[model samples]
Target: MSLKAWAAKHYARRVVQSDARWMAQPHQTQEAVFKKLIRQAKNTAFGKDHDFASIKSPQDFRERVPVRDYEQLRNYVERIVAGEEDVLWPGRPKYFAKTSGTTSGSKFIPITSISMKEQVRASRRALLHYIHESGNTEFVNGKMIFLQGSPVLEKKGGIYYGRLSGISAHYLPAYLQTNRLPSWETNCIEDWETKVDAVVEETIRADMRVIAGIPSWVQMYFERLQSAGSKRVGDLFPNFSLFVYGGVNYEPYRAKFESLIGRSVDSVELFPASEGFFAFQNQQDDPGLLLLLDAGIYYEFIPADQFFDDNPPRLGLEEVVLGKDYALILSTNAGLWGYNIGDTVRFVSKDPYKVVVSGRIKHFISAFGEHVIAKEVEQAIQEGIQAFPARVNEFTVSPQTAPEEGELPYHEWLIEFDQEPEDLKGFAAEMDKSMQEQNSYYKDLIEGKILQPLKITTIQAGGFDAFMKSIGKLGGQNKVKRLANDRSTADPLSAFKTT
Candidate 1:
């Protein structure tokens, strides 16, 4: 091993040890974070309004602060954006992570200094843990790339504002700076298609080892690389060994990625968002990501089934049950209190508090009283691929409430396949069967003839990309929604359907 690699491995050992201590005491660490957050922000406008001074326990917090989505919290956020001091966090946020909003246009999430530091620390520890467990620090010596938004920031109310990924770019550790690929100039290009082309040109010949990004955008980079050299990505960059990703479940895209790279590489999954750096994969063999109990965030969970209730039962770390899905709520040092980030997760293990992102709280279908989520669909697709080998590049599911003459309402699956199954009908049947098995409500609907078995609409190669490009959401933290309750996604995708 090179001197740098040896040093990294040595440092990784200490990081693992430090991480183990907090991981062993999940609830205690969370309580400390909770207390610290409440104490620090007690005097802020939000805290004061919520009577933080009187808060003494988790129950007190739940009673005082109602669970709020971004829409409900916009008034306070707007005040902060107008240069108000001590509005949210103490003083002002270091940056505002600009993200696409639903009812509100362009949401700005505050990234306080304390929160930013935790984000950086959690990401670094994820890598260090990998090195400690696998003892594979050789990748540190080679080129690394994180395909992300441009680093250019726009100033707003005296705070730097940009996408969370862009803000993160300015905070990359110095050690990785030398090894990071795709020159800064290329990264700053505003147009994603143009920027990706530039990235391909710059890193085509480099010894890339670690490539990190959301899977959909990274797939574009991989395709561009393959098209440029007519070689599998694994062959083009033989040293490429680790794939790090977050934002969306990667299982649906796994077959295509493996085919593109021509081999399976080790991967680290992260559960991070503009709201907070929540978790990271700590075990090489485990699918669950280690919940960051010691991070500057306190977590609460509402059982997914009860999330829509007017008064859902909010549970702390000690109250969460394994295997039950929960709508994740956050009370972070970043000044978010009882915040619903709209992600749902299931605790896979509680020994050290490990969770798997189950689906988005809002991303599901219940058109015919059959609630099907992203996880169920993704797993069903994976099951189909296992039963009948096919490579799916991209896919999305939505309820097709209206169909042609004599057709019943059903779920429509628009699939972009890199390699179509020899028996497409059988493949669809397998997926439908798997879905029925996973969700009993869906099974009841299917059996009762309220909904027909899901139908597949083949998308032409590059169809999804074209749709994304048309919508001006082609890259950089943008993800194709896996499940839509309505045809908002399905209709747009229909334009690219195969004849």
Candidate 2:
């Protein structure tokens, strides 16, 4: 083998060894513990349906409450955002988490006292399991990194479609107040650059150890850190113990993160959402533990094909089977019952309900883990095109595969523009480069020859707006859906000429 190839192999083996350090936490009593909470949540939601609130004789919460989408929540969300009380929650909520979903633009979810209590405590409890990764997690008092987005500062105090800004502002520990991000990011300034700068300053000033947030934003933080003369995180915070993240797959960011940080810190996958703090990666090397917020909310898992069913299989805490992929349904303390959050995950084991996010069954690409999820791929494509001088007025990503001539399946981007691409060829090449650099799985897949390289297709201006208009999704709360996994918008790239 060539020396470079041997070195690459050596490095891959080592990283795998490091990743393999994670071990599953034993689930001796977690099922019984979480099930009781599920029963109580059901009782709280609708006074129980067909023994639904019975721990000994459980019921699927779905039978009691039909699934309601955000459209059903339009009035309720407005009321909460307007700072009024409504059926969105049982009572006046304490806070609101503005998270965006695949189909929706901005979701201003209500955070009730009960739901907050459930989410916060469950988040803390999940940390206890993260201790397994630390080799000594209890006493992990060190600098941390929170790679989160700038907070959204709206006068209405309504929840919207961003994650870090409002939620972390309210929940950051008092001890970490000095470490909190500046108010400018959370204020009403509309400039993305200004907001990024404020957060970048806070990250640099704190000498943080534990980093958290979406991988893209975190990478921006690290890039800014490099410009500020701090390349390795070890140089800034030798006491760094953990790197926490969620929102998208981590494999792509791993290499870049490691390269930037210089040392391997325990990476934790926290399954938190605007609605609830779901599951967490408990072990350092292994998959995480789903510490079901036993008290915070009740959960229902519907099979993928049965989502539209009059009688869908809805499994509750005690009854949820292991190794099955299910669409997660939640009934939160904020008064959302039988709410489908639009993410699909599978139970790896259930004594403690260990699970993995399989994919967004609705928003994800149908390809093998190429994972062209809507929001993320859109963002990545945006970032990818930053290197190009062209003004990207519109773009769409769709699944494409080889023709009868026979080639691998891949993702292709059809971008529409105002200014002609300064370097159309360059942008396409750079787009794939940026994506590969960001996701390690994509890199491994590419290296293993699992996928044909991601391809970009450019089109005339106004095309994106035309497409969005066709879908009746024009303007403020609605953006054109990019990164479709199916052949809905255009034919799957099967017939396209291989680039």
Candidate 3:
């Protein structure tokens, strides 16, 4: 091994050894971590308002602070943005990770120094754990490309604002900077088409071993690489071995991605958002991601079935049961107290808690009480594509309300295919069957004729890209919503349909 690879392996080994005991006692570790965070932030306005100084336990914390979404916390966030110190955290946050918003154009999530450290530590530990568990360190010897947003952050209200990936780029460890691909200048290119082309030119001939990004964008890069006369990604960079992806389910894109790479590579999934880095796939055999308990975030879970209740029970790590879907609530060192990040997850294991992200709380279709979620839609699409010779590039579903009386509302799916399916109607039927099998509510709706059969509209190959581009959300951390509760997203997507 090269000196850098040897150093990386050694460091990873040390982290694994140190974290093993804590991982075994996740509940206890989390309790202690939560207490420390409470104590640290007790003097802040939010803490004081929530009676944090007197809160002795998780239950106390929950009772004192109501669960909040981004909209509810916007006032305090605005204060911080307007140069108010100690409004949320100890002082002004070092940066704010910008994300799409419902009311506002964007939401700026504070990233304090402490929170940034936690994010970095969690990411490092995740990578190290993978290396330790897999016993593979050769990839560390070659360049690892992280396809991320622009590294050049926009300064707004005296704080840096950008996507989580861009914010993270500013704090990459010195060791990683040396082996990372794509120069800082290339990363600053704002246009997706232009930037991806530059990325291909810069990294095509390099000894790349690991590529990390959202699967859709990574697939785009791979296509561009192939279009530049490369037969496959492996042909251009034979050493490419690891693919780390998150932000969307990988099942639908797995086959297409493998075909582009020309071989199967080790893959890891991460559950990270603008709020925090929550979990990562630690073992190859395990499909669930191990929850990061000791990270600088205190977690609470509200059962998905009970989430709409006025005062649903918020369960701690010890209270969570296996195989139950829960909406994640977080109290972070970044000054977000009792915050609902809107993602739902299910605990697949309990001993050392491991979870699979189910879907987003808002990203569901319940127009006629079917309550179809992102997971279901993804799985159905995967099953649907199996009935034909094609692969799903991207897709979104929304309710198509009846235009006139007596017309039944139905789910409308706008799909962009990597290869056009031979039998589009058959594909739609398969998807309907899959959904009926997965969700009893959906089955009832279909059988009762309360809802019409799902309507599938096949879009041109790059329809999703065009839709995102039209909305100025074409790349870098902007994901196509898998399921929208309304026609707001679906209507615009329909405009991009292929002739």
Best prediction by TM-score: 1
Best by lDDT: 1
Which candidate model has the greater TM-score, 1 or 3? Answer: 1
Tens digits of per-residue lDDT for model 2 on 271-312?
877677777776666774454544555566788656667778
Candidate 1 vs candidate 2: the TM-score winner is 1
Tens digits of per-residue lDDT for model 1, 1-499: 8999999999999999988899888888988888988999899999899999999999999999999999899999889878799987899999999999998589999899999999999899999999998989999999999999999999888899999999999989998899987889998998999999999999999999999999988999999999999999999999999999999888878889999999999999998899999999988899999999898889999999989988889999999989899999999988898999999999999988899999999999988878788889999999999999998989999998888879988899999999999999999999999999999999999999888999999999999999999898999999999989988888999999999
Candidates ranked by lDDT: 1, 3, 2
What's the lDDT for candidate 2?
Answer: 0.58
* Model 1: lDDT of residue 371: 75
Per-candidate TM-score against the hidden true structure: 0.99, 0.63, 0.96
Query: Order of candidates by TM-score, top first?
Result: 1, 3, 2
Q: What is the C-alpha RMSD of each candidate to the true structure, in Å?
A: 0.8, 11.4, 1.7
Residue-level error in angstroms, candidate 3, position 232: 1.1
**TM-score for model 1?**
0.99
